[model samples]
Target: MYRYDQYDHLIVRERIAQYRDQVARRLNDELTEEEFLPLRLQNGLYMQRHAYMLRIAVPYGLLSSAQMRMFAHIARKYDRGYGHFTTRQNIQFNWIELEQTPDILADLASVEMHAIQTSGNCIRNITTDEFAGVAADEIMDPRPFAEILRQWSTFHPEFIALPRKFKVAINGAVEDRAAIAIHDIGLTLTHNEAGEAGFKFMAGGGMGRTPIIGSVIRDFLPWQHLLTYTEAVMRVYNSYGRRDNKYKARIKILLKALGVEEFARLVEEEWQDLKDGPETLTREEYDRVAAYFAAPAYAALDNIDPLAAHADSKPFANWLQRNVKPHKVPGYAAVVLSLKKTGVPPGDATAEQIDFVADLADKFSFGELRVTHEQNLVLADVKQADLFEVWTLAKSKGLATPNIGLLTDIISCPGGDFCSLANAKSIPIAAAIAERFDNLDFQHDIGDIELNISGCINACGHHHVGSIGVLGVDKDGSEWYQVSIGGAQGNDSAIGKIIGPSFSGGQMPEVIDRLLQVYVRNRVEGERFVETAQRLGIAPFKEHVYATPISKGELVGEDHA
Candidate 1:
């Protein structure tokens, strides 16, 4: 895990002091709501339906035990005694008081964390794969580059007010766990013919009103020019991006207006002046950042043979099948601690659960953990010998929910329940689906289905990429969920297509049941839900979902597709 130096420490402390005064002025009526909107948003504060919400950045999803403990303390002392982790690899406190936010930020600053750049029309937190360093298929560790970007983007004067909020994601692994194709700018670390490290740049990928898969701008960029080239792209976007309409402000919309060839040419032309300037990365600087993420002291497995022998237990086997993933290190594994229990909202953790995980990280994972974009936590370097013990402790705490890629492992946003922008509630829909698919055996039989729900088309839940995507809509002041099929995330990412009519909140569970049943009846053995849907198209599922009502008064016949 990366620690803050004096420079990092100074920046956050000064920002906290500044925001503290700003909050005081607002409370005293020295600032009106309109006057204080941008000021508060700059500090990651948002006015939600019930109260203010604060989002705290978790840089590249990495956390140390100390930082985890800080989050626990924040949840216990600030807002409610829980925090919701988000798909962007950040955490949100829903019941915040405007007056208390400065103190919360100050506490966060104490632990080398801050909420700066988590909101606002600025470059947000740079994210990467959760299994960056220890993944078996990684080309390189991306956190060093992500950290470099974080340092470069935080409070960068040039991007303070962009056309809209921007995001950047990097993927170093063969698997695209970061969902790079849907970010404002996406980078994939790769090697050139000379075997030297560089990047493949993708630009204008986003998922709001218009979901787009980013286009390849540069097939290969030398490592030294990484920052300079990025600056060039930012300059191009900041120059021509639409500012009049918020809907058309994202770089993706801009890219659509200007073709990829012209956009790439513009970026290349801008890169001429900045390519080898002060921003060109040096080997020493890269090494400095990379050294921080080097492997920790892992023990030899031969020393713990006794514990490793006990992995055959039924519970341990089930957990091992779902929770544990292969590690690059010989005797270690990456353990996923699921946050998607049946009753709990996806990606939420209570204060006690936070503390418990913090302790577990210290005990089993070299005091470090990583948050996944899929709303789960990863003990990235847990020794194989400790797997059984970790499983036992986790199961007791309601954290061991052997359903990582199953239907019940849903991804959802805090919809009408917390966000003012939401058109309908998302939590109840997620809970209902989870309850309906509570059978783990059944879920495993179905296999690798992603179900994502968003309160609105803003797509905060990444609903655009789910195998079964659910979007809440405001239809005549009532909540309606429109379903989409065949959406996917990762290297082969694709936005789902609308299947048929929108369903009332009451019909969502039954609709999902019919879709799954259709899938089971038509799918070949060993095929995942997305593969089956793609193979058979959405017709079979659509037919089953929109079939004549089993009962007289059913609303399934409605046609609002």
Candidate 2:
């Protein structure tokens, strides 16, 4: 993890002081809501339906055990006894008091953390693959570049008030776990023909109301010019992106209107002037940042036989199968703590759970933990020998759901329960679906299905890329849900297609059941839900979900890719 320098600490402390005064003014009525809105948003504070929500940035999803303890303290003392981990690798504290947010931020600053750039029209948190340095297939660690971008973008005057919030994601692994295709600016780190490290740049991708995958603007860019080229791209967007309508303000909309070729041409023209400026990355800077993310020390040990160790326990075997992932180290595995337990909203961790996990991280993972973009926590370096003990502890704390990529490992936002922008509640929908597919055997048979729910088209839950997407809609002042299918994340990411008309919230579980039934019936041997859906178009599933009163023969006839 990157530690803050004296300068870093000084800047955060100053920002906290400034925000403290600003918040005091708002509470004292010296500043109206309109005047305080931007001020508060820049500090990552939002006025939700019931109370304020404070978003805290967990840079590149890395958290030290100390930082995790601070989060636990905040949840226990300031907000309610819980915090919500979000899909962007950040955490949210609902039920915040405006007067207390500065104090919360001060505490975060004490731990080398803050809420900077988590909200507002400025460039939001720069995210990367959660498995960045540890993944076996990684070409290079992407966190150094991610941290470089974070330092460059923080309060940059040119980009402070862009047309809309901008997001950047980098993927360094052979598999694109960062969902690079869906970010405003996506970078895939790779080596060129000459064996020099560089990037493949994709721009204008986003998923709000208009979901579009980004197009490649540069097939290859040298590592040295990374920041300069990024600056050029942002300059073009900041200058020409739409300002008329909030709905059409994202860079994706700009790319659509300008065409990818023209957008690339403009970025190229802008880069010609700024390619070798002072902003060009230097060897020393790269080395300095890369050193911070170096791998931790590990004891030399042979790989343990998990099967032999847990021979008598099916529960341990099940957890090992679902929750544990392969680690690059010989005697270690990465364990995902599923926050999507049935009946609980996805990603909600109580203060007690947080503290327990912090202790677990200290005892098992070198006092470090990671937050995944899928709304889960990861103890990324747990020893294989201690797997049973870790599992037992997690189970005691209600963290051992053993459904990392399964249907019940849902990704969802705090919908109508917290956000005023939500049209309906998403937590209940997630719970309903989790309950519908509660059987572990049944869920495993379903096989690696991502069910994402969003309360509205803002797509915070990333519904556009789920294998089964449930989106809440407002229809005639009542809650309705529109289902989409065949979507996927990773290198082969694709936006899902809407099945048909929206269904009532009460019908969601049944609709999901019918869709899964369609999948199970039509699937060939060893086929996953997504593969089956892709093989047989959305017609069969649509027919089953909507109950169109069509014959099986008619559905078969319509199932053409």
Candidate 3:
């Protein structure tokens, strides 16, 4: 939780004034829709199918309880009664009024938050693991570096109008919870043989028209040169990335055209003049940023099995197993507040739910919480002794579904319902799958699955890396769903392969059921669905899904794969 300085406050206030004038001009007919497009996009405002959508940045997914309460207020006053959390750990309001946007921005600014860089063809929000500072497996805390990048990249003149939107993610843990492999620029905090901290830098990774896992550009970049090296990569991209077609403009496309070796060479050549320059991070600067993320005070206590007393309570035991994660500190845990309730849209929270979560964070988690890229919220420092109390309160609010990493814990985008770019509605399909596997016993039996749904190929829902991916496509003016298998996130991330012909939306539940059956039949003991699919390849699952013949009317489109 980085506090805003006087300069930070001044910057936000000035931006709010500028945007207010811009909105007024648009409303007064002084600026036409064409003229207002980029201006509004710079502030994270979008003209959707039905109304405007506003995306607010939650940097590195960190939020204070006070800020969460502000979000609740905005949800209640500005746009409908709820807001949708996104895969990037940002939040969106679907129904926004054109004239009220400035007021909303002002409200956000009051809380040291803004919509800046949430959209536009510039560097977007920098993201990382939700459990960054507290993960037991972390080699180092990455938030300081993430914050440094945030400060450096915001409104950088060189990158204000890049070829396409750029995303960066960093992971400090052994597990790749941040999905570093699928970002434009990915960094993993590591140590050299001498045990000095540095980063394993990768570039040219992205998902969209073309999905690519980033290639490691530098095995060990010294920590001090983080900014200089990053600027070098951006300089290479900004210089040669395509400008002719928006579809081919991402750095990944450019990297593919020119081989990785050439890209690395170019970056190194650019780094020669910039390395060890004034932009090199000093130890004092690192300490100043790191101070903001220092651990909260804790009483002397020993680790205890909080679940021992709840052995007879199946609900409590199940929740403990699924929603609670181990903490780096003794007698503490990180608790996930599930947003994947069966009837609700994935990652959405109502105003009351938002307020309730804020209260819970204050009471249980040092007045702070982190938003997971999986569309859940984490109370990163809850006492293990208070697990049952936290669970009880969250369950009453429909925020404790006990489905983390399970089939029911789906990651989905606001599809045709809110986004004009979507091909089909994503919410209903996600609901169908969640309802089908509503039984906790069944989901647990399936074991640690990442099911992602996207309305289109943009991969906002990250379907490309799901254990099972559902993508919405338009076929002959009708909405159809495509299923893919063997996709996974983390260190060994891979894009999923389409199983066969696309099926109608109505057939999705059964299609998923069939895929799971193949996994169950072929899997050896202790293997997860993705591992089993990898071991057997896509042939068995494809055969199982298409085994039962159907009428020609049921098929929507032939598999492009």
Candidate 4:
């Protein structure tokens, strides 16, 4: 819930005005699509398969109730009446008109939001954990640092163009909810032996043609030098990162070619000029930014009695156990609004649901909301005593699917339905899997599982992170999905191992059922799917899935059918 200062306000307003004129010029045919490509991309506009998609930056995934309401307004006014929340913790409006875009940008500016850095090959939105301010295990709130980076990168002359799209993620918590390890630059706040805060600077991570996990470039970059050090990295990348081939353009690719030692030497040389520059965090700037994200007021209440009583009385006790996260404050509970309902696409919240979330944020969580890296919205500080009341309101809004962090809490892309690059419909695949695992009691007992579906190999859905990753590809124009297993997000992030031959759309759900059956049958009594699969490898599951069951046609014994 960071507030905009006068300077911040002016820059956003000016950007909107600038983009508005540019949009007008494009419509007037003064600028061709080729000429306007970079211009529109700078403002987060993209010409996707079916329509123009506008991605609006939600810095660090935090949203004020008012700002979120503005998203609802935009969704209702332009394009379809819904927006897709993405893995990068931003929202996308597909089916946008060329002309109405500027008006939408103006409206977003009014609410202190913008489309800048949401597209193009420059520094993108700086993402952190959704529970930064309220998580029980946080070392410190990450938003102040995120905001500082925003100012440093936004419209900065030097970084206006880069070799490729750059991403940065920061994490200050024990659990790496921000997926920091897989970003272009990852910063984790940690304490040194001297008991002072600094960042564990990770470099060279990205996903695309070549996926990589970042290596530790600087073991402990002092907190005061955070911005200056970051600028050093960007400088090193801009000066030497590849521009020859788009495929080999990311900082990660450069780092891979140069080797970590040589890259670190280059960064060290660059950092010498910026150890005490203007972008370095001063006490005044730190205090000013930190003031905006000071923790919310909470009334002390006993959670033990009320939560125990509710747990005993409620049918959603299983849900309460899986979806609800612990809050830093004693009596507050961080509630996740699950979009992963049975027979519905995961992470696809309707426009009505957006408004409801805004309302609930205003009423229940101090007028603040957060979108999770897992593609869900969160009321970060709901009182434990009001869990039932919050659940009731959420149920009416169709946000009461109790599958957060479970197998059904799948991550997916628009697939063939919305993506031009997609060969298959991913949403339907997500729905079919969710429907297969609809039983709450079963899910609770089954434990945590991740299912990621992408329409293509572009991996927009982060299929590399899912426990069972499904990637759609075309085999002679028929939609086929390739399966991978044992992928994980968080601290030990790893890309999944591919199983075998791909399956058609109709065979997708059946394949998933077979995979789950293998997990269920082979697992130790209390073992989770991820653990069991990791322990036993994908061979067992692969064999079961490819096996022709009783439901499938078989050859006759005497004569071939």
Candidate 5:
């Protein structure tokens, strides 16, 4: 993890002071809600259903153990003892008083963390693959470049406000876990034929009212030209991106309106002007940034029997098998701390659990924690020797759920409970599905299933990326749930299909169960749920969910099978 340098410290402190004054002015009625809205959002604070929600940025989804403990401290002391990790790899604290947000910001600053750029229509958080440095398939660590982008975009005068929100994700791994195609700007770092590092640029991708995968506008953008090329991309977008209507304001709509070739030509024209500017990253600066993200030294360990460890019904072994993945280092495994426990809301980690995870990270793994873009926490460099110990400590805190990549490991948003835009509750639906799939072995057997839940169609829950997506819709005055199937995340990103008409909240679990059961029965041997779905399409699962009879008092669509 990069420790904040003097320049970093000074700028962040100044920003915090500025936001504090802005918040104070708003509370004193000096600024109207309309005027304060953007300012507050820029600081990662939102006026929500019950109270203000404060989103804390975890840069590149990386946090030190000390930072994690500070988060737990703030959650316990100021707000409720709970925080919600988000799909964008940030954490949100609900129930915060608007006036107290500045204090929270100050506390976050103490740990070299702040929520700036987490929201509003500027370049938001620069995200990357969850397993950036240590993934076996990674060509290089993407965080250094992510950090470069973060610094370049933070309060950059020209792009303070755009026509609409913009996002950027980078991945160096052959497997794209960052959902690069679904970002406003996506960069995949790879080596060129001459063995020089570079980025492949994709533009006009986003998810919201409209969902479209990004197009590769520029390939082989040299390493030194990252900032300049991106500056060109942003300048083109800022100049020509739509601003007429909020719905039509996204860069995706603009790119769609202009053909990809024309868009690429425009960006090229813009880049030609800004190609050799001061913004271009020099070899020295690149090395300086990369130095901060070099992997920590790990002690060598002997590999033991991989199967014999599971004989004693080691509760942690089940979790390790499902959630942990092989590390580039031979004796280590990347540990995923799943927040999707049955009956508990997805991505909700209490203060105690947060503290426990932080402690576990220090004791068994590196003294760092990573909040993944998929709304889960990761201990990225745990040695294989320490897996059992880490699992026990995690199990003690109810964080040992083994349902990773399964139907139960749902991704949910702070739906009606917090988001004013949401039509219904999301937590309960996620809980219901998780409980239904509580049978651990069954969930593992299902394998690599993604179940996403959103309170509404805003798609904050990443419904567009789930194998089974649950979207909340309002009919008249009641809440109804819609299901989408066949979506996937990772290197192959695809939007889900709406299975049928919406169902009442009560029918959600059974419908999900039926969907999974259909998959279980129809899938050929050794086929993953996603592959099975692709082979057969949503027809089979959709048929079963629609055909199944529901209990009395449950709402069903008129066109039921």
Candidate 6:
């Protein structure tokens, strides 16, 4: 919700003009594809398998209804009828015309949005919990710090071209909804024994071919040194991170090669010179940014039990149980508009649906919504009294599936369908799984689960951290799906282990069903799928999934057959 000032306005307008010129040159054959590649990437344009894909940044996942409407307009006018929301909380249009991207960006700039730093080996969008300011468990709102980082890092000359892409996530809540452990740099807002707010800094966490959790670099970095310390970390990585191979270029690879102690030592040595310098955040600067995120005006009212009145309404009760979240404020609730309807691609919204969500945000929330890292949208400040009405409207638009955190609430990437880098189609795999578990009663019985699907090892869908992960692989020039179990995100984040050999796309649903059976059988009372998997380990699940040889007919569709 940070409004652009004169300087912000000037910077965006100038960038757009520069990109417009660059795009024109590319079209005119004045600039070769090699020359225009970096320029276009810097602007978040990609040449996909079919058409160009444009990724627009939604900083810290915050969006005003006005911005949402702009997205809807862009989807309707420039791209196809729908856009894909990504795991990073950004949105992508798959059928973009390279020539029209500048116009699209100009349209975005009108709403104080841009596509800068969305791709390339630079610091991508800084992300955090969708319920940042409204979470009951938050120690402090993390958005101000996130915004401060955003302002500082945008086009920073030193980090514009790192050895590989960098990502940072900050979490202010007791729960790690932001998945801090799997970021290049992760910060947890905390207070020192002296009651001074600071961060628990962790670095080197990432997922790809080599998945590893970040190590804590500093137990308590005082709030003032946030920027200085962050710069120091970047400086260390930039100085020594590998440039030879893209696979080993991430900071996590560097941290692994050097060890945590040495990495921390280097960062500290670098920080000594920068600490307490002008880059150190002062109270006044903090306040300036914090003002934008001050609490919204609320009506004086007591909290009410929403379920009391909807007890007889099964549909309403189901939606309330899955989609509604507790708010920090009384008389309010945060609602997730589920994008994981059975047949729809995960995290995709049609132009009309996007507009409808914008309308809902205006009517129910404070004209705002937050995009969850889980590929859902959150109306973070809905009145509890208006829950039913919100649900009714959302369900009518196929945005109220009541499957948040459940098996069908899958997080998936636009795989072979849109991304040239993908090995197999991810959307269909997600669709098959969702259809398999469409029964609400069966899903609730399975309990909270994070099921993620990625087309490749890039981990864009964050399959490495899902309770059940499905990864698409290229096997003998054929697309096969690999299943992993026991992974989880949050305070106790862990990378999943591959159960066994890859399966045909058609075998994915049956494979998942077998994994769940193992979970249900081994789980004790009150155990979730992840808890049960962790307790019994992957052996039992692996055995059951591959135990029975599937008939040849099962491999007939969407596979090498």
Top of the candidates by lDDT: 6
> TM-score for all predictions?
0.97, 0.97, 0.98, 0.95, 0.96, 0.98
lDDT, candidate 2, 1-561, per-residue tens:
899988788889999999999989989999999999999998999999889999999988999999999999999999879999999999999989988999999999889999988998889998888778877688989999999999989989999999999999999989999999999999999998899999999998889799998899999999899999999989999989989999999999989899999998999999999988899999999999999988899889788887796699988899999999887778988899999888778999999999999999999999999999999999989889999999999999999998889989999988877889999888877877788789999988888999999999999999999999989899999888889998888888889999999877667777888999998898998988988888798888877776653222110111100
Error of 2 at 30 (Å): 0.8
Candidate 4 TM-score over all chains jointly: 0.95
Per-residue alpha-carbon lDDT of model 5 for 138-170, expressed as tens digits? 988999999999998988889988998888999
Residue 124's lDDT within candidate 5 is 92
Put down candidate 3 lDDT per residue, 36-99, tens digits, no spaces.
9999999999999889999999999999999998889999999888989998999999889999
Please list the Cα RMSD from the true structure of every candidate, rounded to 1 decimal place.
3.3, 5.0, 3.1, 4.5, 3.4, 1.7
- lDDT pick, better of 1 and 4: 1
| Clashes per candidate (backbone, < 3 Å) | 1, 0, 0, 0, 0, 0
Displacement of residue 534 (Cα, Å) in model 5 is 2.2
In candidate 5, the residue pairs with backbone N, CA or C atoms under 3 Å apart (3 or more residues apart, or in different chains) clash, namely: none
- Where is model 5 more than 4 Å wrong at Cα? 306-310, 552-561
Output the lDDT of residue 377, model 2: 94
Give candidate 2's error at residue 211 in angstroms: 0.4
Which is superior by TM-score, 3 or 5? 3
* Top candidate by TM-score: 6
> lDDT per residue, candidate 1, 214-259, as tens digits?
9999999998998999999999999999999999999999888999
Better of 2 and 3 by lDDT: 3
lDDT of 1 at 389: 84
lDDT of each: 0.89, 0.89, 0.91, 0.84, 0.84, 0.92
- State the weakest 10-residue window (summed lDDT) of model 2: 552-561
